[model samples]
Structure formats: C-alpha cells, structure tokens
Target: MHQTETSDDQNSRQAAKPPLRIIISRGSDASSFTVRPLMAALAAGTCMLVIGGYLAAAGYMMLREDNSDTSRLTQAAQTRFYEERIAKLRARVDEVTSRSLVAEQRYEKQIAALKKRQGEINARHSRVADVLARAAESGLTIAASDPLPVAKPRPALAFDATLAESTEATGGAMVPIDASVDMLGLRGSMGGVAKKADRRTPASPEKATISSEPTGASAGLRADSVIMSRIDSALDVMNRQSETALDLIAVAAERRIARIERVTSSLGLNLNVDGDGVGGPFVPLTSVSFDARLARAEKAVAKLSSLRDGVKSLPFGSPLEGAHDYSSTYGPRLDPFLRSPAMHTGLDFRAPIGTPVHATAAGTVVSAGRKGGYGLMVEIDHGDGVSTRFGHLSRIVATVGDRVDIGEVVGLVGNTGRSTGAHLHYETRLPSGTVDPELFLNAGEKLSGIL
Candidate 1:
C-alpha cells in the first residue's frame, strides 16, 4: 500500500511542471532571451520609424511647390512696372518735341517780317537821297539853327562763347538760339537820321512820335517798327514842304498875270476870262491836296509865260525908226493951221517930206488910202483891240490886208490934209479911246528886263 501511494504522488508532481520555451543567440557563450519577446519589441520599433519618414517626405514636397508659385508672381509684377514707366517717358518726349517745333515756326515768321520792313526802308532812303541831290544842284540853301549829332554805327551781335563752342562741336546741330541782340541801338541810329533830315527841312506840324519800347518776337522786328515810324514822319514833312513851294510859285505867277491884265484893260481885252461852256464829265471840285496844288501852280506858270509872249508882239515901241524932233505933244495944244487953242490928237514929229515911216510893231494893214481929213493914211490893226494910224501921209507903201513886221516901211511922212507943214502924225488908239503913244513907249522901256 505504501508503494502504491508513492507512485501516485510522483505522477501528480510530474503533471504540474511548466511547458518548453525556445531561445536564440548570435555567439556560443552569450546569454540569450526568449525569441518571442525579442520578436515582439522589434516589430513595434519598426512600425514607429516608418511613420516618421513618411511625414518628413510630405512636408518637403509642400515647401518646394510654394516657392515656385511665389517666384512666378514676382516676375509678372516686375514686367508690368517696366512697361508703364516706358509709356510715360515716351509721352513726355513727344510733348517737348511739339513745343520746340511751334517755337521754331514763330521765329521764322518774325524773321520774314523783319526782312520785308528792311526792304521798304531801303527804298524810301533812296528816294530821299535823290531829292537831296536835286536840291543841291538847284542851289537851294537849308538853314538849321541846331544841327543833329551824328550817331555811331551799331556793332554786330555777339553770341555766347559756350554756345558757339557747342555749336561747332556738334556741327551746328546743337546750337542754341539767342533772341537778344542790339536791335535797340540800330533803331537809335535810324532815329538820328530822321532828326538830321528834319533839321535840314523847314518846320512843319506833321511830326510823328517814335516809341523806344521793344516789340515782337525778335530784336530785328522791334528795330523795324522804329525805322518805319521815322520814315512816315519824313514823308509827312516832305508833303508839307512841297505844298509851300507850290504856293509860292503860284503867287509869283499871279503877280505876272495881274500886270499883263492891267495893260490889256485899256484896250478892251479881257484876259481874266474862264471857259464859256463846260464839256465832258463834270467832276465836283474837292479840296486840293499837295499833288493837285502843285499841278495847278504849274499850269498857271505856263499860262503866264504865254501871255508874256503875246505882250511882246504888241505895238508899244516908237513909231519912227530914225532920229526925229517932236513938234507937238499928244495932248491939247495950239494947232498951227487954226492958230487957236485946239486939241492935238496925235504926236507931231518933224521930218523931211517923203521920209520913210516904219511900223512900230507887228500888225496887218487895214486901210491904206485917202481919208476925209488926211490925204493919205496907213492904218495898222494890232492884236488885242489896238490900232495905229499914220495920218497926213505923203504916200502909202503898205496895201490893205498886208502883213507888216516891226520896223518895216509902211508910209511916207508929209504935210497932208489937216496939217500945216511937212511932219508925221502918229496916233495910238485903243478900243475905248485914243491914248498917248508916249505911255506905251514908257511901259515898254520899263518891262524890257522882265519880258
């Protein structure tokens, strides 16, 4: 029975022991642990490492994409800014260029106007010079109380040194235009010339005032205005002078005409007569200007010249050609035949019988025959209602309608009817009545120098 109990206890102890476990090691003497625990720890470490690597790779990709997008946006902004800047610069250049062109055009126009004015001034100066030359030749004297001072010549315009050098370096392309010059000095010189001219001429009321202020775009234009003003003033002075000269000439002509008319009045000759009828277009008379007054004065002078020539041909000289003694004067004297106070109607010149009697002036014989009182007579009809009669003539040499020149033999002196002795009777008759022959002879002597 003891043996059976011991076997049963051994069998129970063997059944309660643990199961077998496996281990692995790298070296032969190294301590080792269970394979299952090692495998479980390795598996957990590998899973954690794999998860960290995946997170790092995703973050790198996001950063690379963000950098590329920002670079593209920056490049686009820079390009737009440059393009706008270029547009503004181009617009500014165009505006500057347009202004330069307009300024150039205006400068050219001012230059042209100045040139035209200069030409006009030159023309007027030449005319004035010619007039002065004529006056000198005619011995006309001009008296001036105060003489004008001579003006110095203006110097040429000088450009800036910097501008000149730049122009030369750039072949004249980059030259700067200088509008300022000595135009005011040039105007002063012209004014001096005008003042000199005025001093030489007579005083006149038509004077112009000159402005010294600068005008127009250039110095040349301003000078031109000043010169033009001087020229206008000179023209006005010349006009006035011409008018005065014409008036003086007309007055002189009128005096001559008056003298001639006075002598013709006694012969019933009307020299101061106008036209009987008006013909052609009837133009209304207006106020005469300088030119018209001059023309009329010239006409008057010509008419007076013609009248003077006519007066020279009239019978105003002595009737007898040779030396002879006057017995009876041409007034109330005692007649030799009646021996009483009687009127002597003609001049009695003592001469030999059959003495040649010559005509005193140019005329045509109207009667050359015997009259009621005079045995033989020779009557000559001068122009302008004047007549000469040689009464008591011995013989008549000129026939009726015969043209006789001055100092030509027209009859013979002799004692004929109504005469007492051998003498010549010369009678000067006018349209109104008889006149003394001595009066005409005295007038002829006085007018010898003028006529």
Candidate 2:
C-alpha cells in the first residue's frame, strides 16, 4: 500500500511536469533520445534563439524608421532658417534704397531754391549797375577800384561712392544725376561780377573816389548777403539826397514868407495872429532827426500857402476891365470938382457914361449907398483889416453884404456927387490909415508874371 501510494505520487508529479524531446541524424543514421534534462535544455535554447531573431528583426526596422523621421525634421529646420535669413536681407536692401531716394529729392529741392535766389540777386545787380552808369553820364566821376581775386572753384558734392561700387559689385545697374556742379559754377560767376561792380562804385559825390581794394571773405559770401549790402548802401545815399532837397525847399519857403510878412506888416496886419483870415491846427516839432526836417518843411509850406491866400485878397489889380485914362491920381492932386489942391484919397479913371466898373480884389461889400462927396459908393472888407472903396457911379450894381470877387462889376462909371464927368474913383484903406492905390497897382503889375 505504501508503494502504491508512492508510485501514484510520482505519477502525479510527472503529469504536472512539461514534456521535452530531441532528435539527431548523421548521414542517414538516425538516433533518438528522450532525456528530460537535455530535451528541456534544447527546447529552451530553441525558444531563446527564435525570440532573439524576432527581436533583432524588429530592432532593425525601428532603427530605419527613426533615421528617416530625423532626416525630414533636420531638412525642414534648415529650410526655415534659410528662408528667414533671405527675408531679412531683402528688407534691409529696400530700406536703404528708400532712404537714398529721399535724400536725393531733398538735395534737388535745395538746388532749385538756391538757383531762384541767385536770379533775384542778378536782377538787383543789374539795376544798381544801370544807376551807376546814369550817374557817370551826368558828370559824376567814378573811380575804378582794385579787382577782386578769383577763387579756385570748389568740387561739387558727389553721390555715395561706396553705394555705387556695391551696386556694381552686385551686378546691378545705376544711373547718377549730377547738377550741383553747374549750379555752383553759375553762383561763383555772378559773385565775381558783383564784386567787380562794388569796387567800381564811388564812395561819395564830394570825394568821387573809389577804393581799389580786393575783395576778401565778403566775395565768398552768399549772393543774397552781398545783395543786401548793396541795397543798404543805396538807401543810405538816397536818404542823404532827400535831406538836402528838404533843406533847399525850406530855405526858399522862408524867403517867400518873409516877403509876404513885410508887405502885410506895412498894412498894419500881423500874419502870426490867429485871425478869421488865417488859423488852423498847430503841429508841434517833436522829432529830432530826418522826420523833424520833414515836419519843418511841411509847416513852412503851410505858412506859404496861407500867405498866398492873404495876398490874393488884397486890392492889387485894375478896377476896369479895359484900359482907361486916369483922370486923377492918388495923394496930392487937383480935385476936378473943387478945382483946388486937395488930398486925393483915391485914383479916378475916365470912362464913357454907363461903362462897367469892377472890383480890384475879392471881398464882401460893407456899404453901397450915396455918401458925402461920393455918390453910389461901394465899400468892401477884404479880411485882415483891409478894405477898398469905389465911388461916383451912375448905377449901383452891387448891394451891401454881397460877396464880390476881383474884377467883378460893382457899378457903372458916371458923373455923380463931386465927379466932373463919366469917371470911377477907387481907394485902398487899412486899419491904420489910407494908402496910395498906385502902390498896390504897381506891385501887382510887377508880380503878374509870377502869379
């Protein structure tokens, strides 16, 4: 029973264990073995070999796939880097080109402005030259000055040499536009001519001498600056001439005022008094320079005008329009009616009956009625205490308070009052006393040409 139990136990153990087998053949002689240890070893070895072969094949396929993916990623990264670099380079080139174009346009505008200014300067120089020539022709001497030294022409500004060379190296074409040379040359020539002209100009009329000094830094100055200097000099000379002319005019006006004042003073009239005849707003002398001279001249001219107006109101013309014989003279004369030596206050003109009698000056009639020894007499007040009387009229044509101008008919010549026949009597009176009518008449005759 124990043996049976042990064998059953062994069989049970054997059933639980796995089976192994091995076979060997050599040249058709076959042999078989069934050792559990050897079969187990052989089966384990075969399984190991089969697993190793499968793992090696899988590893080789994985390695090849990894290599292909890595190569694609590297190529993509390299392409992206090259593209970014090329884009940046193109942007830089465009920026440089735009800036260069802007700079070129700015330079062109500057050149145009400079050319316009040069033209204006040339025109002004021509005008100054013409004026000098005219002065020389009018007997004004001009001395020649030393010529200005010519300067070496400067090289014009050029385009960027480096940029041009780069373009050529890159096999690119470029066209350069250069105008600064011509413009600068023109400006230099104009400056030279102007300098020569300035040297020839006389310094003063009195000296009539010109300096022959060579131009220095001033010749190198801009055209506009040189023109300004010439203009300033011309203005100064014009101002001096204006001052001289004003002085002459003032002197002449003073002489004329003096003469008028003297004549009015003899008639007991003060011209300085602000009478109804002459008065206006007073302008005071406030300036101390050229303006003061102008003010004085204006005042003098105004005074002269006032004096002339006053003189016009005085009796200084023939009462009759036509020529007539004088029947009597002013001052000590024989009275025709009285037939005696008496003081004759007026002059008598003989005319046909009913002949027109006129006024010798402009005035308002004060009295126009019959008076003692004077019939149909007309008296006129010619302002500033001056008056005139006309008498012995056949008919009174003018009434009292009537304004009459010089040479206007006032009455008719007739034998009336103390007059012997058809005649007219005239008298000139001032505030002080009566004056001789012949004096004014003679003065008027002398001044007729000027008037």
| Tens digits of lDDT, candidate 2, 257-278 | 6666666566455665234354
Each prediction's TM-score versus the true structure: 0.41, 0.45
Off by over 4 Å in 2: 1-226, 274-288, 322-325, 353-355, 445-451
Clashing pairs in 2: 145-212, 146-212
**Least accurate 10 contiguous residues by lDDT in model 2:** 193-202
C-alpha lDDT score of every prediction, in listed order: 0.57, 0.59
RMSD of 2: 33.7
CA RMSD per model (angstroms): 30.3, 33.7
- Model 1 per-residue lDDT tens digits across residues 295-390: 655555655666655665666656664344455556543334433334455666656677788887789999999875666889899877788888
Lowest lDDT 10-residue stretch of candidate 1: 193-202
Per-residue error (Å), model 2, residue 286: 20
TM-score of 1: 0.41
